[model samples]
Target chain A: MVNERSGRAALAELVTSRSVLVCVGSGGVGKTSMAAALALEAARRGRRTIVVTIDPARRLADALGLERLGGEPLPITELIAASSGLRSGSSPTGSLHALMLDAKATFDDLVTRHATDRAQAERILANRFYHSISTTLSGTQEYMAAEKLGELHTSGRFDLIVVDTPPTRQALDFLDAPGQLARFLDHPAYRLMTGSGSAVSRVAGAAGKRLLRAAARLVGSVALDDAVEFFRAFEGLEAGFLTRALAVRDLLVSAQTGFVVVTSARPEPIAEAGYFLDRLAAQDIPVDAIVANRMTPRFTRLTAAELRRIAAAQDAGGDQVLRTGLAELIELTAAAEAEERALAPLHTGRAIPFQQGPFQQGPFQQVPFQQVPFQQVPLLDHDVHDLGGLEQLRQSAFDD
Target chain B: MDPSAFFTGTAVHLVAGKGGVGRTTLTAALGIAAARVGLEVLLVEIEGRGGLAAGFGHRALGYEETVLAERIRGRSLRAEDCLVEYLGGHGLGLLTRPMVDSGLVEVITRGTPGIKDILLLGKIRQLEQARCADVILVDTPASGHALSFLRSPQGLLDAIDNGPVNDQAVAALHLLQDAARCQVLLVTTPEETPVSETIETAYRLEDEIGLHLGPVLVNGVLARTPHRDTDTGHSNPDDPDPDDPDAEGRWVRELGIDRDLAHAVQQAAVFGRRRRDAQRRQVLRLTEQLPLPRLEVAHRPDGIDDLGALAEELLGGLRAW
Candidate 1:
């Protein structure tokens, strides 16, 4: 039998993620559910917690027993009481709140926060490119998510935040956006784009204008002028944007922040998880936990020899269809066994150190990385849609 | 709608689905299938997932296009290279090369999210216009991001009332919304979350984004597993009573495995049907609500491993549609 209690304890140890707990995984791997569930578990432990997600659908909201989600955190007191079948006075001591990201609103909020003046802020907000990007682009959500994180951290709203980054490539975009924006704020190119605010900007701005003129001849004068106007509106807000970006980046890799890399034991997700983990390790960001979600469960604990004995015994049975079923069962058990073997290392949270570069020129030697605490969320039968469902999910991941 | 109609005069195909729904596999399968039908095919992937190359049994592709199989070419769209291509399209290579060399392009595109998306989409438009292939197939980001990517040009247009950036967005909108030229295929697994997301994606792409809907391919569907699951919405002939005539009795006579093995088989059926039934309901819901055609691919116990298997599977899926 799978040791349910031990798995839960291992998972509980990682729950001490006091600052930020980021759950990263590929799409449709229960990453969002895990985020909210982790928050719920934290609250049950008497710790004030908030779950933040960019999930557009109502999955998180439904689990929190809310009709809809918005940018602000919605406390789940009523939902928790209802799930526990308790009256108001018997509510849990710790607070639980949830927030769904509003990308455009967050972007607009950032603009308002960073603008030099109301008029300049309005001008930038009205800029078609700014409007388009804030509302329609891929990175806007990630950028806003990161931006919101900084806000939550500074506000001192909760002791724990369970957040999930955007999926796949955007996960990197979320991580890299702060640095990119910070670098661009100080870059000569950005200075040129925004035009001269200082003596240095003047020299760079002149070169930038000539290049814009050159660029205008190719793309058309109208487009270049539009780009210039878009840049010009940001004349004095670079510092504000830069400070916040760097601050968020610092918070992400801080000691209090813990990352849990979620993936299935399947080959594809495991391989991708390995690459992502390596990227994290390369940056010196420690991952405290790993959740191998939705594994093909071991249906029976019978050993191979016992199975063989049963097979031979069943051959002389009465029902012909039962005989056929036996053969199919044998075939499936073998596959599951093989799958478990392939994913053995991941179950134990054993880190197999790998080199990033192919060549042998580096001073680094092959070394075993640290083992993270591990937990496996069983492949569940019912779809998660309610607060009670989340409790079931939590119990599956954590013994408590 | 006929499945082959998807190929007729369709210059751009955007394949989107939830993560791990086999978007890359379907894109490669389409590339191979199209090439086999005597059309040059170009498959492009963004975000450098290395899925496209791996799908075709080739090493991970770089920024440049490489031959994958007969009449098929694959390329991974990297932001840096796309920046070079974007400037080259403006015919300002000599002057702009220095900007790229100075890492100015990197800072600008990296900080600015839509610029990179534009560069990638612009490259696809170029391939479409240049007749580089009979059709260009793109394995786009997951549903939400794909929707944003499709709408990115609108952001540019809105940002620039008059400019080349505005013009680019206008042109992109022209191609993206022109139903005769573009067919967006939404792939999804038969799971609660993925199915709901797929339906949402379909609605947004059709109504909000204004793209032509291609056949929604419900992939990774479970094949027949031995057992009768009475609880499913779609009950099959294999319900577990021995008296059920259609049940395979002969195979039972040939059985020589233990009860644990039998239990595993029984559990696999229960597992398979839960998903199969889920997929069936979602697909039915999709077909019932939308005017789009639907196709089903039988789930291989082991998923689409490489190019050859996917190509074969794609044919079966297409035929089923």
Candidate 2:
């Protein structure tokens, strides 16, 4: 039911809109590629674009053909300066840039920025709970990703920004995390543990002193002394942590943000995507679109039986099907049809189905000095590392 | 039939729950327990989270089976790798890797919409048929996606009127239905969302796929204090008598704790017990709808880090069942 013109049309709409585009899905579903493609399409149409990826794997960099990215945004200079003569030397149109999120470092920066002093910052950092939360809390990385996206959006450097999210469930965590952190910050037990000494605090302190004496009598002074020191260190910065947690909560529930659930025709990912969409709706987050990637193109003249026979023969160790490969033809056609059907309901914006490439084993060895067209780039071997690779990937995103 | 009777067969046991609910950890534990009882087990994970390997404390697992412990092995079920291996073994290795590569495997596997589910199920079926394992413990995707995977074959069969895929679909369905061969165990935490999802998944599997649902393993269940009367007729230790001034004195004297500290401890303990009782109510609700046993695995204070704790908690007392 998708309008033939809708894919490019949707990209154009996104180019002009001021809203944020958040791409979310399960791992290995071509989400990164789709985000790049959207960003590329926007840039080609003369809109300034930036695509940010929180994927730890340098797939975005490989897709963009960049060597590496830091915390800050880097210009995708190669794509703009390509000598291919197809479209070279910074078209008077616009520009594209990309950045990968380093969540732990970003969180560390946030703590330092928000803390009152060096002692307070170090105290918060040194807390076992904070260290565990900052590094390994299940959803902390994804939340940090959203925080980075918000930072980029606030900068006003680009007309459009496409964010490729982490795994689906974790991405939802990004949506829910600020609230969870707020609850932890506001817990009564946390208040009792951290507040300046009051009536309850005096009582708790007297009880603690007696408990320590009893513990010293039973298990020796060393263990009790260590515990007392740990508790004492926690008393300094409870208010500051609570304040920052509240600020982050406010930042999340703000406007100017949107989500797009990206998925393929595969059942599990589609189902997960649908679940995510439902959750997003429940949370009042706006889902602008669902991008179904790698749809199979329908073919003519080949019946299902004929395709099966070819597959069966191919399975039986025949080279005829492999050389001419009616099976591949059949598979491609079936994929297109499956994608169309799977994405039939979400045809409101656009359902761009780029041909899905195979999983790459490792990084590419050669650097192509010349302009490499996206389609001719190795289907399986190439990794999306930088802006050049992303631009090449973007070039391959249309009806061609 | 006894609900647990489903466990004593050549069945594909799918462990499904919400994220962060110890589904993967439980799957590994079930595999180890089943293996110890002499069932050759293949623990499968589709998410590529490396949870299986991490749970079993293995370095890493691949598309091929890697032995983690005695009789318990792990495999990463990559659809493309499986197709490539099947094709190469069957003599289509001559096909250009690109033609086989560029979404061809995914198309054939993922064609017919839910065909990927059928393919994944087919892969599991092949492993079962090859006597690769007596029990295939699938660390399935989360509830929604897991249901989709289970319902995929039926989805395709319904969509396509008749075809080679349909034939394959029917065969897969037959394999799933023979409860003597394959069974599904719904795993859940005692939270509102995961428990609700588990109940819905059970009904959907039964209604749609005709697969026999097994026991609901409610992991991380809280434990409550046993109620008893003291000499003073304080019927519930949780319920303090404000009328009896001696009650407070007695509590402080007996536990040798301050009134405030004792009150805090009592409140925390009571809160935990009440939470568990609420969870038990949900479990009882599930029992009313499905003719399945509910196994409660009590919450460990430190949390489940590896499979060993899982075995002790899940299978340690199952002899009574």
Candidate 3:
């Protein structure tokens, strides 16, 4: 069931050939670490690479040897130089950079860039409604992530860009963001809100006007006026925003981009990965590989009956210590086997009956996409928190 | 040591943790545990695809509560639905259809940043005040958004001065601050990243949000016997244990085990030992860093099918706590 060649070759191709690699998975599944390791591989192969991470733990920063990452890309090759043990000339063309996504700051920058004038930008920026939406709106962060990717891709400074997306279904929002923004910009209600006349005056019916007044009263007229002003100021910038949003959409589905779905050997995350594969396949975005992280090592194939016989014999021999020890060993092997069973749907074409119900199948059961590599990273004894740990991860992921 | 008080002492329990830390499953297990104590429990999941209901072996949950078990009811909440409900409560019931269908609610929710979260909390507050259930278990968003979700009420209170929305925020904030009304239950695994995030989240919740926290749940900890690994003696035939004479020979000859099998089992044992040791260190670190009670849930080999067993284990943990 282990296809080392395909897995290694696919990973190599991802870093070497693809311009953009977006790693998506449920939270706490080591998606961030996997992304960083893949970016490190690209850097080591002499391609300039940058990894854009979202809400990574502090230890992951320490792992990458960066003191801190903010909105701007910071060169990290020098930071990891001492720990990585690289001589000066080895892969000299290779370079690595990293940045943490600041969604609010990115949105503000977009507003400043697209606005017709500084006064218009300031008018919108100073509005409380604008401030709130930019920081707290559901799709803003995801749209900003897509915008940042588009920015970096246009910069053409790096050969490879790896994005560690936000967790769960929100990661899918990052894909829909561009189109959602474009559609909203074109929505008639948005135009009505930003219409030149007073919003109440523009409503044709008494009921429409009454509901608008009620909404205004519920949120308070002061706050509602601020929203009106913000949208009015935002009207002229729509063309630029629309053009950029469409460009981002184009970049996401282009041939240079690839999606790598990361998951663990757990049922929930595997189900999530399957959902992601189905979504991406529906959109025709190519998935480069599926990384199954933190997999327990399958050490033995011995059944519980065989192990119980050994333990019972040891019990008869009066070596109770050996008996208990063998029992614990049996439990460990059984657990490893369970992990393998959990991961089977990702590899085997057939669906097996779970204790609860039939196993949920993903795009892995379908053809062509079944050719996508399944790279399994064994659960290491120690937690991964530094460049050394990342190097170990890279070795396991890239080396056959 | 009685866990009945833990169930009915608070009106609402917000179960929160990083994604994949089993927050939803733990919420379901807590509801089951509460129901076992003869309390009617309402499991509330926000912006999820019926994960809480699925935990109880049911289909997706809607806005209306459905009986999931003997005494447990579950429902799912979305921001838009909460807004519609909020509007209806404000005597705008007739306006809901046109407003929702016309994208006005979406516009209002999008225009205001924290309003969506505030609306959800406001609904939860209403549920608590109306005594809809004996206990309400809210499975909140993952840790990344949990802070913002909890902070939204206060954020709205600061942003809006005099309005119905402001009044709602104040009420939600009051509920969150009232120790008898609500408490957050944090869940984490005995791993470096999760433990670290849990500790940070605990302090932030206490200091920033001024919210009361319940016991920290250390989920998926490896359960081990209190026996030393070396006491099993060496399985290496090339280098027999001097402490236990002919231990290897006895294992292969008397125990009917081959040397290769013994060696493989020995490696497996070593791996298990190391994994357990690492987790122990993490648990110890969590104990030393945070000043809260810790509840340990053992790893389940059977996965989702073990929720009932986990609920029983949680009740045992609460009893000990």
TM-score of predicted chain B versus true chain B for each candidate: 0.84, 0.84, 0.90
Candidate 1 docks at the CAPRI level of acceptable
Clashes of each: 16, 23, 1
Top candidate (lDDT): 3
**For every model shown, what is its TM-score relative to the native structure?**
0.85, 0.47, 0.91
Better of 1 and 3 by DockQ: 3
DockQ for the candidates, in order: 0.32, 0.01, 0.45
Ranking by TM-score: 3, 1, 2
Better of 1 and 2 by TM-score: 1
Those runs of model 1 whose alpha carbons end farther than 4 Å from true positions after fitting are: A1-7, A55-67, A82-91, A113-117, A136-139, A172-178, A197-206, A217-236, A302-335, A341-370, B1-6, B36-39, B101-115, B161-164, B225-273, B303-306
Model 1 chain A: which ten-residue window has the lowest total lDDT?
A355-364
* Clashing pairs for predicted structure model 3, backbone only: A63-A386
lDDT of 1 by residue, A6-97 (tens): 55675565565467888887766777878887887777766678889876555576555566898888888754554353233433566788
lDDT, candidate 1, B1-321, per-residue tens: 333555655889999987878787788888887776677888898865676776666767777789998889988887668766667766677768767654455544443456667777877787788988887899998787788778777665644455445566677888889987788999987666677678778888877768888878877765544454533447656455443433343433344434444545466445544655666666666666666766766665433255666666676666665
lDDT of 1 at B76: 86
Candidate 1 structure, TM-score to reference: 0.85
